[model samples]
Target: MDSSPDMGLFGPESVTWKVHSEPIVTMGGLRSLYLQALHPRAVAAIAQNSGYKSDPWGRFNRTSEYVGTVLYGSTDEVERIASRIRRMHSRMTATDPRTGERFRIDEPELLRWVHVAEVESFLSTARRAGLKLTDAEVDTYYTEQLKAAELVGLDPATVPGTAAEVAAYYERMRPQLGITREAAETALFLTVPPLPDFWGNRALRLSLNFGPARWAYFGVAGTAVALLPPWARKMYGGLGLPTTDLSADLSVRGMRLLLAGLLAAAPEQYKMAPMRRAALERAGLA
Candidate 1:
């Protein structure tokens, strides 16, 4: 385990290091995808290039691995993955249905949109799901994530790094965002993803049986939607508004407890990503 200060992009003392280590933060990934899909061009690109509907689990796993690498991998590993993504994005192109104009996936605006939506989703979900952190800590988390944005070709200085900046970014970008057909389909796919016949072992298969899986998935999806900003929810036609904040709070709290319990019960080796495990060992936390 490398304990050197410059090994990883972010050290243990960073708010991003702490926030991302929590098991509960995994819940935000879908919410971030849903929010990112709201942008017409972004959804168009995904619909055209990604096998999200056909191989949802594969897409999810890939996303999880990418995020984990960024959060916990050594500096060289981080740059390697980031460069791969950047090269991939540069070669991909999507045409605007409305204007018939083709645009590269690595366009600055699209990169910024994706970056902001994802980091905001992660921070918001962690806070709402009962991962305790102060307002200043939240700000620090946002600031630290600019490195991630830069990895994907976004200008770190231009990206939002505070709650206020995020809000303003959303407001400014609102005019360009709306529910496209692709986005609606994406929302549906996320809410009721098709599970594979066999995942891992019998225990996993039983848990993912259609009836139980649909019910459990809807519950988690509903909570994720509920945790979105009101404006974002409205854009999705009020998909997950609880009757009251009390209900929303209770739902999120229950999810937090459930995830915490699962993490505690699972084997330590299974609970953490390989890079994360190594980083923790290096920091003397494993």
Candidate 2:
């Protein structure tokens, strides 16, 4: 685990690469954030430690890049980024609103919570968006991501490394989770953040910031929330009905199809993260 080969942690042949190289996974990331925020202290840690309110997309981009680098970056790059995160988390702390007790951000339970949430969200969201992944493949993806948990200082054995383990982990954790005011506010902000300007294109930014675009972003956010588990959605005061799930499934599938088409025609630079781009370039696919 200390050194990665040319293909990095999970190479092109891996289910990790296959699942992550999809447009729908952006919504998956959003879903993970929503799920993570369900834990009061986890959201509090995020709210207090990061400038997500002032720079949401920047925070998101960094998270996305970290995942990308772990999946596709070389050995040194992965180790370097992981070390930086461990160092940063080692210094930051957050308080529990319920007990008024302060805690380090990188506590083992908190780290495990975040990791399982991301893995579940990413895998489930991909399946809902119509990825033809099998149950065994789901287990494979989970097993492969064990290294990701390790990178952040968790013992792989302590983290869920299979679908059943993840389900059991959530069951054990649900009673400890609750909706705090911070979690609600974070969800609201994520649903309605302003559109970001594109590559200094003022005109394009202005053009894209219209009512429809805002509502469209809201739609995507809502769909991501919809993919949350029934209990989790109910805690958010959302209707956890079958119809809502059906509607979200249709919306995600449609969006994924549309985005796949658009991405297929997009320039190479526009369609991937730098780490992924570099990997593709090495494979002569870029």
Candidate 3:
């Protein structure tokens, strides 16, 4: 494997590096997926081509690995993964049931939606979770993530790179987005993913099979929903909340504290990506 002395993509000094290194961002992954599903064409493409429902964890793991690679891998590794994703998207297409029009998965609009949704979710979740990022740093984080947006075939110039820009982008996209049946179905699946029978631990499987897992899942699902923007929450018909922003804030803060505590107890090697670990070692920070 080729290693770079330079920090790949955003580098250690970048806000993206600081924010993404946190374990709490895992919640943003679910938020991003849920938000993306609300885009009818994106969800349609996913349903047609991906095994998301049957292998949600597998899909999520692969996506997480790719994101980690982009954030922490060598320059060549970053390009390699980005190129692979571009090739895959270029070969896939989905037809819109509403219009009967076939569109490529790499369509600029779809790519932009996925990119913006993910970046916005990440920043929003980190802030709500008490990550202590200043408004300027948050803007920097968004601007830094343009490199990631470009990885998914979006034009960086067209992507939003500030909080205000993101809000404007959502405003512009609101008319095109809604809670479709596919979105609703995907949301349900995300909230309560079925545990595989062959999960290799009988006791764990039994627990999930009974009720504990479902209860735990609902707690997480509720928090993920609470993290959604007010507009998105409304679109989902108040599944996450029917009350006040204060309640949502409190829930998110509590979840953040729980995640932070867990991360604190975990070993450094377990909490960080391998590339990040290596970078920290090299910098004498580990």
Candidate 4:
């Protein structure tokens, strides 16, 4: 029942993937992937594609480019591009930064996270560019996606049954969502936002590399923003961070920074806290 994964981003005993009653949620869904194993895999992907050294910005750009090709390209084109990512991931054998244990690139956990991330990326980016959905609509979409997740071999217990339950689940898992938000903001401030035109009209395109974690985050965040008290929504809107518009066509890097900024500015509003710590600890973050 303790489905935590070690996520040693900083170092062993430094970072870990946290778990919750529901899976890690995001405004766009790929955030979960960026936080866990996909972080490394994404680095690997960029390294392979461009032979570029994997710094934060390089890795972030590669992620954005990969997403663009897969999501925005024609189905045939996306499949071809995705094949490269698949091949890259296949050749990778990574050590857990915490435990130094090696893992196959295509392990179920990794694959599931990747799948979710891609779905989330597709949906969130689509929304950002001009797609629309209602709370009920998203809930329905989530319900169907859960079925798809299960069919694709996502563990049944890992799926959330309702939107509120997803929020409550994240709250239970990390309790550090707010603190992580602070860290996320700090990270963002240190990095430049991806240029606005970098994505261009490509936002309308769907990619296979979309991370599920980003999608879940987008969905949860969107739902949270909409369902907030009118005063809160107005406040957030005044800040120019409306959930409805936050995830649109945002580069993966932009999305990360935007989310971080929101959390850092109003950690209380998002209930950021130690939940990620527990989840990461379970994953071997500690």
Question: What is the descending TM-score order?
Answer: 2, 3, 1, 4
Question: How large an RMSD does model 3 have?
Answer: 2.6
- Tell me the lDDT of model 1 at 109: 86
Q: What are the per-model numbers of colliding residue pairs? A: 0, 0, 0, 60
What is the TM-score of candidate 2?
0.93
Model 2: residues >4 Å from true position, as ranges?
Answer: 1-5, 197-210, 283-286
- Please write out the lDDT profile of model 2 over residues 58-167, one tens digit for every residue: 88788888888898887788999999999999999989988999999999999999999998898899899999998899999999999999999999999998899999
Which candidate comes out best when scored by lDDT?
2
* Model 3, residue 102: C-alpha shift (Å): 1.0
Candidate 3 per-residue C-alpha lDDT over 17-70 given as tens digits, one digit per residue, 9 for 90 to 100: 788876778788888988998899999999889988778778877887798888
TM-score of each: 0.91, 0.93, 0.92, 0.37
Candidate 3, residue 98: how far the Cα is off, in Å: 1.1
Badly placed stretches (over 4 Å) of model 1 are: 1-6, 200-209, 239-245
lDDT at residue 282 of model 2 (Cα atoms)? 65
Error of 4 at 221 (Å): 16
Question: What does the lDDT come to for candidate 3?
Answer: 0.83
Top of the candidates by TM-score: 2
